[model samples]
Target chain A: QQQVRQSSQSLTVWEGETAILNCSYENSAFDYFPWYQQFPGEGPALLIAIRSVSDKKEDGRFTIFFNKREKNLSLHIKDSQPGDSATYFCAASGNNAGAKLTFGGGTRLTVRP
Target chain B: NSKVIQTPRYLVKGQGQKAKMRCIPEKGHPVVFWYQQNKNNEFKFLINFQNQEVLQQIDMTEKRFSAECPSNSPCSLEIQSSEAGDSALYLCASSPSGYEQYFGPGTRLTVL
Candidate 1:
């Protein structure tokens, strides 16, 4: 079974707008949630991450709002710019799983100028 | 910092031929992982190594694919007999704690 599921396959937002990408996971033991960004012909890079103990994490223009009860999380990119266009992947892992990440299908975000 | 690096960024081979890809992990990282991404946008776990020791691997990887990481040498994944189904971007990644892995530019393999 796919443990992590991303809701949107693609999203587009205008410059300076906010783009929200949603992700839901099935494993209850998953405590580490991280978001990765990938550009064309490049590997995915860490954009932001949040631990289960915290409800939210903010870094620069990226924010992750996590809900433990619902097992859901969303990445919000505020003041989106054209350079933010890329594919975003949400991944989850548990403590005992040796930190093997289960990644979602990924959502392609296009920040239009 | 010259993070992870994969050689032969693009590879193409005929069916039944062998294909090989190499990866050099970031300095100071102990754990390395390989993942295969299909055109359908699904990422499949291949195998992983920790300082030359094979930690874990999926069934698909163990059957036809073989990987090795010699001391002080770049890690390599080789296919005995490539098939059309093996066409995909193979990504190599390394992490210090396996929590957040840093990925290298994937090696795109095309089996014609």
Candidate 2:
């Protein structure tokens, strides 16, 4: 079974719009959630992360709205730009999680001009 | 620039041949991790080390795969015998603390 899941395989949004990507996890023990953005032929980079203590975490145009009780989270990219296009992965880890990340299938985002 | 560095941006090996990749984690980051990303876009955790001691590894890492992070030396992951299915991008990451890791550019391995 997949421990973490992303609803969409691909997403598209026009420039200046808000693009929302959804994610959910099965393990309730997961406390730390992080989102990574990957470009073609490059490794994933940490975009933003949220601990279970916070319901929401925002950074500039990127925001992560987390629902610990519901085991779900969503990444919102405000003012989505063409440069924002990439494959986004949602990952989770918890106490004694062995520092091994459980990554979602990923959502490919495309921002149109 | 990226702090985590991986050597040999690409490697090609025939089936049953040995393949090796190396990585240099960011300074002061004692924790190192290796992951295999296949063409299907799946990330498979391989192995990790704390300082020079291996902390954890998956089944795939237990068999044909062997990894070591020697003190004062760059970490390496070697596949004893390459398989067609072994073709993928190998990524190395490091973190000063757990949960907040950074990744390298990755080494693309192609098995024939």
Residue runs of model 1 more than 4 Å from their true location after superposition: A96-98
Predicted candidate 2 versus true structure: per-residue lDDT over B1-112, tens digit per residue: 4599999999999999999999999999989999999997899999989999899999989999999999889999999999999999999999888678899999999999
- Candidate 1, pairs of clashing residues: none
TM-score of the first chain in candidate 2 relative to the native first chain: 0.97
Local accuracy of candidate 2 as per-residue lDDT tens digits, A40-91? 9999999999999999999999999999889999999999999999999999
10 residues in a row with least lDDT, candidate 1 chain A: A93-102
Clashing pairs in 2: none
The CA lDDT at A91 in model 1 is 91
lDDT (10s digit) by residue, model 1, range B1-112: 2399998899999999999999999988888889898877688888988889998898877778999988899999998899999999999999888777889999999999
Relative to the true structure, candidate 2 reaches a TM of 0.98
